[model samples]
Target: MALWIYRRLPGAGAAPRPVHLAHRIGGAVLLVLSLPIAYHCITAYGVQMDSARVALHSLAGCFFYGAFAAKVLIVRSRHLPGWALPLAGGTLVTLIAILWSSAALWQLAQP
Candidate 1:
């Protein structure tokens, strides 16, 4: 969050790139890290459509991937409007926040 905000400062105009290679690498690492958890959840729960928590996690994971793809696309596409980068980044942040609150926090609260 701070990184994104920092990049938005008035002086940041000199560098038009929204994300560094490191940021993209970190996101790739996170995506890889999530795969095991997702696999375990699917193998264990088997997509419980009747369970909102499970369904939400599943949906959020799906959206996370989509957001990630969009972020990458936005980062690489020069023809997009200036707002596109921030919007893509914000969507990713929102999805991660939702996933954290819904899944990570829920797991922590469990006995």
Candidate 2:
């Protein structure tokens, strides 16, 4: 959707149905995939703050869902400004990157 939005300016035509479909499908898939990881993190670790990295990861994990909910609301609402969706989406992507780096990247780097 980001790519589509970026390219869809300055007289670009309306997006095809498949593009919209793909965006919704992708969002659903991502949400489904994230739930398990979130469940495990909350149940197993429960937001530890023993170290800087762990704390950042935990905070990011917690905020990610909130951001997601906000984004969904922005998408559903008609009163919000046009930029709200993209801003919330960008925030979510950044949080996902942070979570990936702090958890997956850190684990991979271990000896």
Candidate 3:
């Protein structure tokens, strides 16, 4: 759907049936995956930037939550311009990839 939205511009193509399903399911997954990590981060350090990794992770987490909320609004609200939903969804996805790369993959590479 993101690709389609970009290719078509102005969200001209109707999202396929599966795109709706994927958006809903993927959104749920992202929400579930984010919660505990967010809880741990906020409880453990309270959004400190004492180190580069911690800072980036904390900032990215903030952006992730913001994007998540925006995406949900995009899904629910009809008043937004057509390009908004896909653009929001894509931003969320790109942020997730960056977070995963910087945090998860970085940890795996450490030892």
The TM-score leader among the candidates is 2
Model 1 alpha-carbon miss at residue 25, Å = 2.2
Q: What ranking of all candidate models by lDDT puts the best one first?
A: 2, 3, 1
The 10-residue segment of model 2 with minimum total lDDT is 2-11
Tell me the deviation in Å of residue 30 in model 1.
Answer: 1.5
Best by lDDT: 2
Candidate 1 TM-score, C-alpha based: 0.73
Candidate 2 local lDDT, 1-111, one digit each (tens): 655745756566667778878888899899999999899999999999999999999999999999999998998899988899889999999999999999999999999
- Name the lDDT value of residue 17 in candidate 1: 51
TM-score of candidate 3 to 2 decimals: 0.73
Candidate 2 wrongly placed segments (more than 4 Å) = 5-13
Residue pairs with backbone overlap in model 2: none
Candidate 2, residue 9: the lDDT equals 67
lDDT of 3 by residue, 1-111 (tens): 456534564646676778767866876996998799889978987887888877877788889899988888887899989889878878887888878887889999996
Name the runs in model 3 displaced over 4 angstroms: 1-19
Clashing pairs in 1: none
Query: Residue 98 in model 1: shift from native, Å?
Result: 1.0
Candidate 1 residue lDDT tens string, 1-111: 325544656565433354555566777898899889878877887666677877777788778888888988887899999888889888888888988888889999999
